[model samples]
Target: MATGSPRPAVLRERVAGLMAGTLTLPLGGCRAALLDPQGPVGAAEKTILLNALAIMLAIVVPTILATLGFAWWFRASNTRARYRPQWVYSGRVELVTWSIPILVILFLGGLTWVGSHDLDPARPLKSTQPAVTVEVVSLDWKWLFIYPDQGVASVNQLVVPAGAPLRLKLTSASVMNTFFVPQLGSMIYTMNGMSGQLYLQADKPGVYAGQSSHFSGDGFSGMQFDVRAVPATDFKTWIDRTKAAGPALDEQAYGALSKQSTDVAPYTYRAVSPGLYEDIVQQHLPPAPGPVAAQPASQVAPVKKAS
Candidate 1:
């Protein structure tokens, strides 16, 4: 007898195994960044998350067990199970059910309220050393980091010193986007014609991944960068090396960079035009062209007035 296609049950089992493998593939070698933090802000946020989960599970787990118990005890075969035909709502049960959720709500609310102000993105982190200010600009599908004090700039790469606070002034050159580094905590928005402030710190030296969280356009998927946190001495060495090479980021160079492109390689600018950041914020250097401006207003025909 010729064996045809495999049985349905076996085929389903094979398909399920393939699907599970596919789902776990992306998570290979990946640690849960939110739960395993590298900085003070991220650790604090993780604590809140775990606390919230435990609080909810306190009520959820018991409710699930109670449901299973009731189903098994009241089953048709359990002749000893009492049936109360006239049973109305019990005050004790109502009190227990309602009080638990109310308590959970109160606890969660208080936690959020305190954490928000404590970890405000604009609030500076306390450190013995001075904070490093890096002006961040979100381009179409890239990030431009300017170290004004150091007189140097870089594209798609952010380098800072470990154990030192970071003061970030973020703005967008094109559409609005969000700047986020999961392991470092705090996500802030970057908008064109407006600037926002954020403070962060890395307690140790490591490379953290960063990206634009908000959807911008076709190239949004590739708008990723790496944050290199190094020792103070290494940070100074990097700045010197950057200053010794690469072309100056002048207006012409910036204009060219503002144009839409994706997956830009990290590069440094030996020198940057003074006040370039301020110019972009103040719109002195015109905002980058966006989707709205892709089609000129003059090209569209005007609507006629009703007769």
Candidate 2:
């Protein structure tokens, strides 16, 4: 009876399986959605990654171990090792060494290219479920989030429903800014006279860190916000209560509000004047612009009717 060796096969399997299993257990498990792709916008991209890594490791782990083993076992001192430095490489090795990486690269690249388009922020929420549209204005060193439908606005805090996609339309009131909510999605830039879009959904209800990924003026360090993902019903109630307890934000008030500041607390404006966000987007909707345009309050208009 011939006794066949199983060490090579067993070693390969054990190493590869260990590598894959440990990675998945720690980084790609079900709970991963909390800090990564389980959320709304990152789902598509994350799925591609999780799927691809699982496939790549099939070859990657084995290939790595083989490289190390080949180097060590085939040392010049080993009499059993074959010496063929001048010998030409075999076609089989050539084909495999080049082909494997090519395939991996193609698959990973394809996944990324396709995901970029599929998860575009502007893409409509195809599902019958409607997403809440949150209008965000990046201030010099702060954030102002307005819920148009809810008819309320908040400084430094954004509230939305967890597990539901959120459509964000962002622009800057003064200098360029960036809106970033880690553990939810990518950071999107905001520019004066320009607008951008970002989509995000949190899988679980939590208060996550939101900040400006760009540097602007003196208060750049303070340009941050809070992202709160909660249940839909609770979100609605939050909006209602915020509106009930806050004061209205009119054009004049907004003009004053857009100035640079930092270390802000959450505050709500009960009634936002219609088109307040649009006005901020336009930049010309302010009370006055240049020094020439600015006149004393007494000179602009009389308190009484000008009949």
Candidate 3:
């Protein structure tokens, strides 16, 4: 009787099953969202993180091993090891101490400088495909995502086509907040009367987690959202369904939606009013002068009305 090795397919399946089991372990087994990203931007960020860690560990590992080695070699029972009590300033020791740290610092500084420009939130993504524009307003404890091209909007949920670049225009309707999607990288700030830009893309169909990384108020813990990426065909189908079944997002509706709240359920709208985002930004601005603007409080003369 001849004994044969396991087939390639069976071997692959067994390995995959083992990986799945390990990933689902109870304690901290949930994957690190930043390290295991679903998009290009997130992957780049993860690379930066790993490179920095490796550079530091280059120094750390040897130092730890040398410490253990010294401890064991100079053990009380060991008689052959030489004593270093009289040694104080060796050239080799000085060189190793200064040069290695200096080199690490220089490398880290250069790496940070280059990475800063590459990961700039305002810089547009480099891609051949057309980008989709989404206007985001950070309201009290909730996120509002507006799809300009589709003329639709959603609260606490964002949906886009996988493999297409996303161009985001972000602002705040109330307090300042941060719009962050861990799997897409980049955390951009949103403030009243100011707009920020961010570029991101999902490489495949999946639902990624998004949240307000910055603390806002009591409801900060509930400031979470979902990013759903689907195929282009499915994205279009979603748009059509939203148009047919969802309600319109107009000024009055937005006013109600902007009120302070917590744990707001995700919902979509079929239609969004044009320039609504711009209007929200304008509302935060100081009133502009009229044809006959009021004089400054100090410059104005006191008015004597009939008593």
Winning model by TM-score: 1
Residue 140 in model 3: lDDT: 77
> Against the unseen true structure, what C-alpha lDDT does each candidate score?
0.93, 0.77, 0.87
Please, what are the lDDT tens digits per residue for candidate 1 over residues 176-274? 999999999999999998989999999999999998889998889999999999999999999999999999999999999999898899999999999
Best model number under lDDT: 1
For TM-score, candidate 2 versus 3, the one ahead is 3
Worst 10 residues of 1 by lDDT: 290-299
lDDT of 3 by residue, 1-307 (tens): 7889998999999999999988778647348798788998999998899899989998889889999999999999999998878877889899998998998898889889999999888788888888989999988778999998899999999999999999999998877889999999998899888888999999999999999988877778899999999999999999999899777999878877877788999999999998888887888332212113345668767899989
Candidate 3's clash total is 0
Question: Which rank order by TM-score, best down to worst?
Answer: 1, 3, 2
Each prediction's total of clashing residue pairs, residues at least 3 apart in sequence or on different chains, is 0, 0, 0
**TM-score of candidate 1 relative to the true fold:** 0.85
Clashing pairs in 2: none
| Candidate 3, run of 10 with poorest lDDT | 284-293
Models 1 onward score TM values of 0.85, 0.74, 0.81
Candidate 2, residue 91: Cα displacement in angstroms equals 3.0
Clash pairs, candidate 1, are none
Off by over 4 Å in 1: 1-30, 292-307
Cα displacement (angstroms), candidate 3, residue 43, comes to 0.7
